[model samples]
Target: MDTTGWLATQRDDGETVGYLEPLSGDYSLVQARNLLGHPVGGPTEFLEAEELLIDRGISELAERWSLRDAPEELDGGVVILEASPDGIVVAHADLAKAGVYGRRVHVPWPDVDLLLSRETPAARET
Candidate 1:
């Protein structure tokens, strides 16, 4: 995405966990998006937003997700194997089973409908 004015938040090891976009005065919007590119946090104080991302870490991105209207070849739940500004790489969850693996698909960032896996606690609550 166009992160023109966004500030990167990093963990102790210098891994970028997320970004903070400055809003009004001291308020900022957190960009700790899921695999679907949906923000997990809303507008809040800049420090609060930063802390949220730090506390959340990058583990949130490892959650399972399902692609909406995906091709028939990819017929089941997937996990984000890799992600970058360019795109994301996902593999069928079935492939990860029994230590058997298969090809991964590269999808444009934020272009596909990536819903949190229904099995996730957050999705269950919603």
Candidate 2:
């Protein structure tokens, strides 16, 4: 299990900022979050997180969504992919032809929580 520390950033008004997983141990959370938007104005703690999308098991989601590398038109709906430590390696079928696949979409862990309706850990590199 990856024990990387992630700073859950939020605004002073309680609006969620995002999650910051520093690439190094000596990183400054204040500076990173400040550049992204604002300084983390909330509690800082270490939490063990896990990736929601595992390698396999339940592949299809009622034809409404599919994995990133799944075949095109497999579900006839949105295909969700995640960013690796480097970036997005594969993209949805529709997005591939548009020349936008493989591009990393930087998203906060909180926003991802809302999307998946549950908090998930950052996908760690094997």
Candidate 3:
């Protein structure tokens, strides 16, 4: 398989990241997310936006709305990544909604963006 072409997401199966050590490869959906926002250390979950759109989420008793049942117009984007340190980043148009407290990714102190990505350990690199 052309590992270089795969996105950071496709490269990961809950363990290893699609790591190209040279860092010359173009950005995929996942790499783009990593570059544009906060860092996502190690393995993480990658969910299609449509998948989440269909799930029923909790809301006030007086208010009930199903992401799946919402009008077609409500659904957008190809994917949503739950990255480490960055939380839930809704990526679209090369932009993501970061700074949300929805999730967490272990980062290098306050300056996460500067942390370099290394190949995960053999045991964890699935």
Best by TM-score: 1
Per-prediction backbone clash count: 0, 1, 4
Please tell me which predicted candidate would have the highest lDDT against the true structure: 1
Task: Please give the CA lDDT of all the candidate structures.
Answer: 0.63, 0.33, 0.28
Writing each residue's lDDT as its tens digit, candidate 3 over 1-126 gives 233343433232343222211224332123222322323332223343212212312111112111222234322321233333333232221123433323222333222343322222352235
* Model 3: colliding residue pairs: 54-68, 84-105, 85-104, 85-105
Q: Give lDDT tens digits, candidate 2, residues 5-30.
A: 65544445543334455545644322
Runs off by more than 4 Å, candidate 2: 1-3, 29-66, 69-74, 79-126
TM-score of 3: 0.16
- Between prediction 1 and prediction 2, which has the larger TM-score? 1
**TM-score preference between candidates 1 and 3, better one:** 1
The candidate, 2 or 3, that scores higher on TM-score is 2
Off by over 4 Å in 1: 25-36, 98-101, 110-126
